[model samples]
Target: METSHDDDSLVNFADDQDDDLDIAPNPDRFRDAVLYGTDWTVRTLLQQIEQGNIDLSPNFQRRDAWSSRNKARFIESVALQLPIPQIVLAERKEQRGTYIVLDGKQRLLTLAQFAGGFSNDHSLWSESAKVGPLRLSGLKVLPDLNGKTYQDVVDRAELGQFRTQFDNHTIRSALIRNWPDEDYLYEVFIRLNTGSARLSPQELRQAMKPGPFTEFLSVRSGDSSVLQKILGLTAPDFRMRDVDLLLRLIAFQTRLPRYKGNLKPFLDDTQRHLNASWSDEQNNVVALVDRIEDGLEFLIKCFGSPREVGRRWDDKRFDGPINRAVLDVQIASAFDPNVRRAVASGALDLRAAYIDLSESDLDFGQAISVTTKSITAIRCRYQSWQRALEKAVGASIQMPVLPNA
Candidate 1:
């Protein structure tokens, strides 16, 4: 739960989140994805995990919610022969019976972590996720088992009687055999996860849209100094808001004219098309990333900080929370080669112009705050900023040419 001091980066960003998961649901994909129910004994499940047959959606595993104590409690639940929730997985067509865990990742991981016995290397999930071997504590019903590790259970030192009992226990599992490409998986993944648990917008997108491009976004979003500075982030957002921010920048850079008010669908379409053609567009995508980076560096130089364009001001310091509208415009505008060049050398200080508008311009304020995701508002923000840039540079800034749709 590493958090940002910036209110908008973590709290406000997550509170507002995105448009909706079902905004672009496809009924066709719903019927196409298939699931079958089965049960696996504790021994077999651990074996499968050890063999690396059970994958934990590596792409979308950027955020983790389970605590060690919670994991220990779940392990205790198994030891007590209490019924645990069913696991859900997607059977890989490439390898029959081998699976990618869609749900119950924590349970499987906990089981693997505990059952690794003495060596952490034997705990497949723990070793892969870099978690240590489980050491149980704080058992309400099983105080006798407190402070015991899996090695203790195996060594016949104490609590050995219950290990065989634990091994014999079975857990229910559902295997999805078929999942055609679409957003339906997002709905099922959300529904199956249950109980106020929702993946952040970009987290869900990685699950729904898996491709080299999506992976590219995930990597680029992590460990970014420029991003950390701009979002006021102490660390990359666990909610994948940082990842979503990169996707938004890419979307608006290439498809701004096509964005008709709805940000969710606009970004969705962009991901879908780009992912399908990522092989051909990899070079172009790299260039786009460079453009955004250069533009941001220039903006930082002009404004004295990235926050100038992204964060709102309260007459003095840049204390106001992030306005997504302003950030997007600033980022999208930076996509232009011409704009970046002008911004880098122009006599006009973008920070001053932005502050002037922020304090005095009613229209800009409304554009940023009211129906901010609306097409009207988005274009209004861009046009207003463009006017300021052009006025400062004494020339019209041409928009970057985009690839054919």
Candidate 2:
């Protein structure tokens, strides 16, 4: 789902055209079909199974490995005339598979498992004893015309007639695989998935986009061990999704305030800017991350016991305190080259100074007042240090310290 717009509005450039098709055709005539009120049957399922078209992407809900209670409840829903979710499937003319599941993978898996006499528990029907392959059976579907049940028609059937009827039942299928017709797919996906475990645009992008940076962040932030450590320090209830957003904020050094839950477009724009502004030596992103990491080490040394800080090195507070310090460091370093040298040579005693300054009896407001003065002093000291270093190195380095903004 690539688009060229902000989070509020998605502007898809390609309309309804096949990926391989070069010719542009009428968009109105090439509409996605919606088939309803038909019995999805065993023969179609078997055909799809044989065609290698069934996609159980991790994005889909977990397999029907539900507890016995949940399985019983689902069966009871069908028995008690409760409305179950309609399965969303796609039918393609070019594809042999009768259906491409858009939704309802769990329900379908449960049905298939039950019909095959596979036990929900770890018994014969479980992995041990291979029960016969599952197929829809004993299903008493009601007729649409009247309230006639499968039992009413069963009496008029011969031996194996029930299986034949079940196999030949008309199954409703929806087709949506037109490459140019992505908007239609997007609209349909949105309509069907909205309000049901609604995934944000950034979340969706993380799933869809292809890039090393996205992959690396996903691994680092999505790891259960890493997440557990982060939670132990910060809010344990904080979602991994939020962590990803914070990473993007740091990576781009965006001045944007705390995200108001609309991060998709912001992420997209940031990625675009990063891709354009990226350079090998002057890679602000890599430099920014390294600086934040260094600053975090300093904060931990100053604010907590060195042991505790190192143990909870990836704490969320590191982002707030240490990352901010790194930002200031970068700003100060720009005006005084020796600030970078001090950072490199450990001349400024960052950890000790940070600890001494932060532990003072001052509220955040008071601390900010002192911090402002301290930063000015540090900047001045760096300018003097740079001149001395320049003289020793026999290379004149100009310092341009900007006035306070």
Candidate 3:
């Protein structure tokens, strides 16, 4: 189900909305969602870090993705007194004054490292531990400053001038506080990070809003048997597209005709709701997972391989990306009580009958021709498949009422 703002404006799941998360909906809450102050100097930020006020955990960032060279460049940029973007932070209730880094993690970490705080093992500490000394090399602007570590600058007044400049440099930080809704923070993180990093929707969800349902998806996505049967072993899931496909299946199983054409938002809403209801909705989750597992096993039994099932159209070859259009419908039909009875009674040869119908059905081609993103097309294809399957199995199954029908 999609949620709206206080004014009933459509809120995009992947984007930030200026809405507060009070059940009573107050305009003042919206205005007070985030709290910011005047720009802070680099020195003050370092002091905050030293005082154990800023949390620099790898909650959202790719750990250690930045190279030493990259860190050097950033430190050099700071020393040169170049302007940088404001760091976004979120205040945690666990610590009254302590804040968590939402954006600008790398920049903040680099500064902390330059001040002799980041341990070589990839953690920033409040104490100025000397486990790993900050060093800068390969300087284009100042060749003399090359190969100088933070210790070298502290010892030399001339080099210390640059260090002083860097310390005094102002880095703005915007703190988000008094926002009771974690969902809004997730949306904001997605919007801010997606522009610079090419994080897939699933990846962004995994990083920004990890929950019980997300953990469930991650575990199921790695099930070798299910994936080998559905997506071929070599199916490159670099972007976590397989997880997305599973999410699609789950979305359809749960939300059905309630789904509109907004694919991303629908998936987002489904996941959010699932995560929210994870404990209370355990039975639904179990039933849905069991049904899908049964459907996949049944499909594999009939087709030999999940990859063999697709929208055949006029071609003798299976085509497209596993054709979810075909999968969703076939699974729904296979689970039909009448169809199951026919199969159990040896009246339905699912494979042979399905192949025959695909070869002869003109309407099936038209149904699959509609864009997969269209809800109408998805429903049409499912209905067409159900009709074909009913004829093949000699089962008279009733169609359920769909949303917006």
- How accurate locally, in lDDT, is each candidate? 0.68, 0.38, 0.63
Instruction: Quote model 2's TM-score.
Output: 0.37
* TM-score, per-candidate, Cα-based: 0.70, 0.37, 0.52
- The best candidate by lDDT is 1
Model 3: per-residue Cα lDDT over 1-405, one tens digit each: 011112212112111121112134446655758677558888889778666577554321222335577778778888888987888877876567787666675677677777744444544442235335567787798666778877788788878788788888888788888876655565556566555533335644554345788767766665535654565544224334456667777887768767766566677788888889999976777687777778777777777666665434347766534555566677776567787777778787777766776777766655554445566766666677677777776657654444453
- Give lDDT tens digits, candidate 2, residues 1-405: 111112212111111111111223555634534444555564565345433455332222111234434443454344444556666665544554444555565555544443322224522233313433332233334222122223333445542454454445443444444434433443455566555433233333443333555444444343333232322322211112333433553532443332222233445555544444545423555565555455444434334432222121132233221222223332332334444455456555444333333343233223233242233433443344344445443445453342332
- Give the candidate order by descending TM-score: 1, 3, 2
List model 1 lDDT by residue over 1-405, tens digit each.
122223434434422443455346457776787877888888889888767677544433344445667877888888888898898777766678787666676677668668843234432333344655678888898877788877778887556768877887889988887777434555666666455434445655665566788878877777666876776666666567778878888887777778666666678788888899998999998898877777677668767866664776555767544556677767665665666566566665677777877787777877776557766666667777777768777778665333232
Model 3 clash pairs are none
- The 10-residue segment of model 2 with minimum total lDDT is 10-19
Best-to-worst lDDT order: 1, 3, 2
- Flag clash pairs in model 1: 261-375
